[model samples]
Target: MWASILIASFGTYVEKLVGYLLPHHMLERESIRRMTGLLPVSMLAALVAVQTFAVDQTLAIDARLFGLGVAVVALLLRAPFLVVIIVAATSTAFVRWLGWLP
Candidate 1:
């Protein structure tokens, strides 16, 4: 488990290092450009979906979904990323504190 964790960390670092070391011209290839542009958003969306919906290897419907809804609304309104996070967290905490989510 420790070895796998280290390997994954090293692989992630290597991927970032390669992304940084690659030349702008190489990234200018149409397919590469499109991929590079979409990759971050795609990754973020996947991360968000997984975190918002999955808990203990099962699909969940809870305060997290409401929090993510707040985040999405903030994003759609052009709020800064920090504000989006703050709003999401605040709403989630409020709902949980109010005993509205289980």
Candidate 2:
């Protein structure tokens, strides 16, 4: 386990080092810029989907889906970030408290 951790740490360091060593012109290219900009959003969406719908390697239909729905509605209504988060959490908790979902 320690060897794996050290290997991973070194790999991460090398990745960052390569990023820093890349040519300025290559980094500034239009395709690279566009891809970099969209990468985080796509990655975040994938993460959220996985977290909301997966439980112990199986698909789940639970309070999280309702929470996600509430959050999306809040976002569409231009709610503040804090408000959206609070609302989603409250809704999920309410559903769980009511024994509607586990």
Candidate with the greatest TM-score versus the true structure: 2
lDDT tens per residue, model 1, 1-102: 999999999999997898689886866689977887899999998998999999979999999999999998999999998999999999999999999996
lDDT of each: 0.92, 0.94
TM-score, candidate number 2 = 0.74
* TM-score for all models, in order of appearance: 0.70, 0.74
Clashing pairs for predicted structure model 1, backbone only: none
Model 1 poorest ten-residue lDDT run? 19-28
Q: Number of clashes in every candidate structure? A: 0, 0
Q: Which regions of candidate 2 are displaced past 4 Å?
A: 1-23
Any residue pairs clashing in model 2, and if so which?
A: none
